[model samples]
Target: MRTDVLHAMRLARIDLTLVGRNTTVLFNVLLLPLLMAWVYTEAVGAEKIDGVAGRVFVLAGLPGLLLVFAVFINLVNSFTARREELVLKRLRAGQPSGPAILGGAALGALVLYLAQVALLAVWMRRSEGVTVANVPMLVTVAVLGVALFCLLAAAFSGLTPNAELAQVTVLPVLLVVLVGAPIAFPAGTLPGPLGDVAALLPATPVVEIARTAFLGGDHLSGGGAALSTGGQWMAALPSFAILLGWLVVAGLLARWLFRWEPRHG
Candidate 1:
């Protein structure tokens, strides 16, 4: 057990090291969220959600932006790249267990995921004077959302015919998160039935929870109250359940479909 843990950690460290050396990926990981924050603010055009200002609204959207581009799509291509290269197959023949190997492969993305969150938080706090209302819940949702997306990315990557198809294969999630879900617009602005459907999507809850956490200006309201046009803290319970349900479902799918050997073999 300890051996697998150690191996996972070592593999994760190596991945992080490689991430540092890869200039283009590193640049995008650092720049994309910041760029989106600005673009979203401009697009929002002085709009507000549930009384929160436009800048803050853009701040809340940071997690979803990072989740899709930085975590989900990036990981989809990453694992597919590894699989196409037979990197995963070579690792499978080594000492680490399958679960450990997959977990380590995901660890780097998760780290990048969390780093984007922290960077955006700090950036927003500095520029927009935003502050986290509930650190625990905020961290919980961020971690959970990242894990969920990462697992889905793994499943998507594993299912893909080849690495070159990642761009096409990943469009559904990109569309769901970016176009289908409520990233740039208020959830309330959507039609009622449509909002319900969007609520069920993965990116919705991540945005919802983050919006809930940043609902207040200075301090996050301690008591769960009516927070946003979509839902409040307690009202967010269903979204949490949805995210958890998707996590389990996607996780099982990944476990079932994930292949260590090359798909051709």
Candidate 2:
């Protein structure tokens, strides 16, 4: 492997170790998702939507929350914290290139989120009988969601003045994301134009793709009407486009807004 790659790997390991040592980060990474998932699933109850368990629909949407809480939000906090401490500056001054530094920091979150996803998959399979029907779409959307959110975090962190301020700075975007996401409710159930708008939210496509991948149907259609692999792809094409668009936008934003040092420094 190249030197930069090795450096990034070392940084990623350090990040993982830091996360383990930080009780707050560890809780957010490990328990927050499960708590949120439980609350959502409970709200859904034993009710079925379109002949599919409402809980399954809720579980299928887990990736959206995971992306936000486990990756995006935490990363914003992580970046801002590092920047304030001059950790990022020290890293940049070293041999690791810009991409390597950013990649290393992001990888730890990605690895944790993937582990949670794996646990979610196993739980869904055993408890809900929700086997992944469209693995490719699932993986594709997951990668896209992680990449886009990581960029979003990096860019957003640039606006944050300090680690303490990150909590406040992230709320507005977090609120918009949570509300826009098809989490507590289905996007399809939204009336006409509202549904169209929801479809455009960054979280929407990720959840939609995950839903189809795990349950084999669109959110509105429910899992009873499982689609074939080809059908799943076709159904998810619009979502794919949406994610790709967000990825481009996020990439641009990261380039423009990402800061190597604290804003006030």
Candidate 3:
């Protein structure tokens, strides 16, 4: 068991090194979202959504964007590139257990996600005076968000024919997670059945969970109420369950469909 953990750690270190050296990966992982946040804030300057500052609203939704663009899309491309290069094939034949192999491959993205959140938290705290209402709840949900998106990336990687095709393959999921969720749209603003359907989308609950931590309300109700930390966590339970459900589905698909070698070769 210790050997397997060591193998994963070594693999993760290599992946992180590679990611660091790639300028394109760094741009998407670090700069793209930063640009988006700046644009959103400028476009909606001083406007309030659900009684929260527009910048705060944008900050709360930033994780959802990161999940789609930074983690999910980038991981899909990375997995497909590795598979086409026969990297995964070699790894599967090596000492690492299956879960350890995948976990290690994904660790770079998880680390980046955490770094992005921490940096953004500092920026928001300085610029917007945003304070976290429930730090533990935020951390817990953010980790879950990363886990869910990583699983989704793994599952989608199986369907992507090559690194180039990842751009096309990830579009549907991007639409679902980014457009259908509260990131692009206002929370609890979707009307009628659209709202119900949006609630079930994987990213919906995550956005809600972030709101609960940062702004003190669930997705269905916009921020601006005082809830105890426990109450805030309680409000996010259903959203948490929704995200967990999607995580299970993604995990099953990844287990069933992931390919170690290139499809054509």
Candidate 4:
């Protein structure tokens, strides 16, 4: 209803304001990835990659991991903190419906995600001289990835016992995305079944989706093309299904496990 939309919008503004004021949240949401990108680029300049187009693959995959960090790690902490402080409890008794409250809480991260996407666009256009060929695919997949991770993040929030433990609780997920996925090293270059194994991780398809969008574009000349950033529409079906499958599974788990009230107190 119109009333729910209005309430959600208002909640989004309030959450955005709070996020803006939190320096730690702001840095992780905005600067950490920027720092990583800079370091990756600098390492590339030092011939650390040992492969041509390494920087390109790095750029393409960084956004997905960044999104995972922001939503899975940072936003989970935010929600957990609010719940522990009884904010969620108060909100539960509030006038806003459940959907509005959840939507609004997520809207801040959604904004940050969009901003990060724009930043990635600028970086690609200016530094790599590359642009996304399938703009719609880029946008759709990015949003879909965020939604999946955000839902999972919320589900995991209940597992975090306290605000301080959020970092520890999210470590497994961070490690999975960091070590499991082919972000720093190209998927194609991975030895043996490593790349194939990575495809099983959630972040893999998200990164592949974005990488395909850029490489599939006409701007960049190919150099170290090992794995196909498959351009054919049909080639993407498996990745899309995998991500959607994870999202559905996570949603089911969230419905069963997510807590609206504080767990400890």
Candidate 5:
């Protein structure tokens, strides 16, 4: 309703449209999933890891990876790009509030996520016969994950010196999500301290919720299992609580530490 929110919304629309038109964004959002799905299928098929199916391997993994890519990496890069381009600085000079500006940028990522979910849902249904068991929990994780990561991304942007380095900063987190989370096939089979640590990482619960929905609550275990014991609905409480804590902490940090312009300025 506020003028600043309107301006931010307008700017976000243009930014998202540009990204939509860009071939690179298309490839990352579309082609990368297909490629990863193929690579994962091949890798698993070539060698059986703990008796997991190749298709189930790909299914368990890709959605969580896509969420991380969309929410964390993409949003951080967008904020950094806008800051380096002086868009954030100029916006600060306008009537829009900081929340509006950040929220607007998040809208673009949310749209991308919706599209990605739809595509993945249809593909999984047809190809793998995968049915989401806890639809509400999955939706909650998806939405909250996006919001939490967007804020965290904005917070990380405070430390990022430039747009180019933004991508690099996000890569460590991405690797953790991709390589560390149990969503990555045999990662579920990992033993001892390494696996224990991975289970507690931010991406783990999100992926757990997603996997619970995909695998019909059978895969939920450890923290996820303890959290969801009362039923699928009750199990989600812990995941939501953790995610909410992240959102609050990250959102506050972003608000307090965010730099509207270049560090040198």
Candidate 6:
């Protein structure tokens, strides 16, 4: 690796270490899963919805949620905090390139998401016997989701005035995921138009990919099927295009709008 890459990695490690020590981070990483598991189990039970159990929903949905939470919500707050402290401004004075700085922050979020995935896997295995089938697709979604959302978070942070408001910025994304991701039951029951719309959402493809891996292959077809064996690659192509488009737009927006010193600066 280049010297700048190494420096960026070091900075990423330091930021991730600091985040790991935060109580709020710990709560979101650890406690929130348990609460979600308990609440989902109570609400959905063990019966099959669209040929899958409530437990499968908990198993698949939790990881995707964490991916969004870490990449979108947590990273936005981190960027805002760093900007407020002039950390971003100081870093801009260094040898590291702009991409290196952002890449380092994204690497930190990826590490956190990986840790959360491990925890979620252990819980799912012990509690619900969740074993993934389409491992490749699952991995793709997780990696791409992280990248897309990290850019989104950084771009969104450009509009945020402070770290406190950063928390509020997550609300719209969170609500969409929580209320719109088709997590309450199964995708089989969704109305035709609504299901079609949900399929196009950034997180839905990832969630569907996760569901196919953990639950089974039956949910891998039609409007809500996580992945179609016939057009699986094709289906993924659109999402990849969308994610890349968003990444470009967000990167451009951040470049133009992000205030390193602060609104006051």
Query: Which residue pairs collide, candidate 3?
Result: none
Question: Which wins on TM-score, candidate 3 or candidate 5?
Answer: 3
Question: What is candidate 2's local distance difference test score?
Answer: 0.83
Which regions of candidate 3 fall more than 4 Å away from where they truly are? 218-220
lDDT of 6 at 229: 52
Q: Over the stretch 173-218, how does candidate 6's per-residue lDDT look in tens digits?
A: 8878776665665544568887777665666666656665555454
Estimate the Cα RMSD of every predicted model relative to the unseen true structure.
3.7, 1.8, 1.6, 3.5, 3.3, 2.9
- Top lDDT prediction, candidate number: 2
Q: Would you list the C-alpha lDDT of every candidate in the order shown?
A: 0.75, 0.83, 0.80, 0.75, 0.71, 0.71
Which portions of model 1 miss their true places by more than 4 Å?
216-233
TM-score, cand. 3: 0.94
The residue-by-residue lDDT of candidate 3 on 1-44, one tens digit each, is 88878887888889889888999989987888789878877877
TM-score of 6: 0.86
Candidate 2 per-residue C-alpha lDDT over 73-123 given as tens digits, one digit per residue, 9 for 90 to 100:
889999998888898999999899999988887777778888888888998
Candidate 2 structure, TM-score to reference: 0.94
Write out the backbone clash pairs for model 2. Answer: none
Q: After TM-score superposition, what is the CA distance of residue 107 in candidate 6 from its true location, in Å?
A: 0.6
Candidate 1 lDDT, 1-265, residue by residue in tens: 9998889889889988987998877776668667867887887766655566666776776686788877777778788888888898888888988878877866777788878888877877897787766666677788888788888888898788888888899888787777766666666567878867876787887887776766533112223244443335566677688889989998998888766656874
Give the TM-score of each candidate. Answer: 0.89, 0.94, 0.94, 0.87, 0.85, 0.86
Judged by lDDT against the true structure, how good is candidate 1? 0.75
Name the better of 3 and 6 by TM-score: 3
Q: Which stretches of candidate 4 lie over 4 Å from their true place?
A: 44-52, 191-193, 217-232
Candidate 3 residue-wise lDDT at 149:
88
Cα displacement (Å) at residue 5, model 6: 2.4
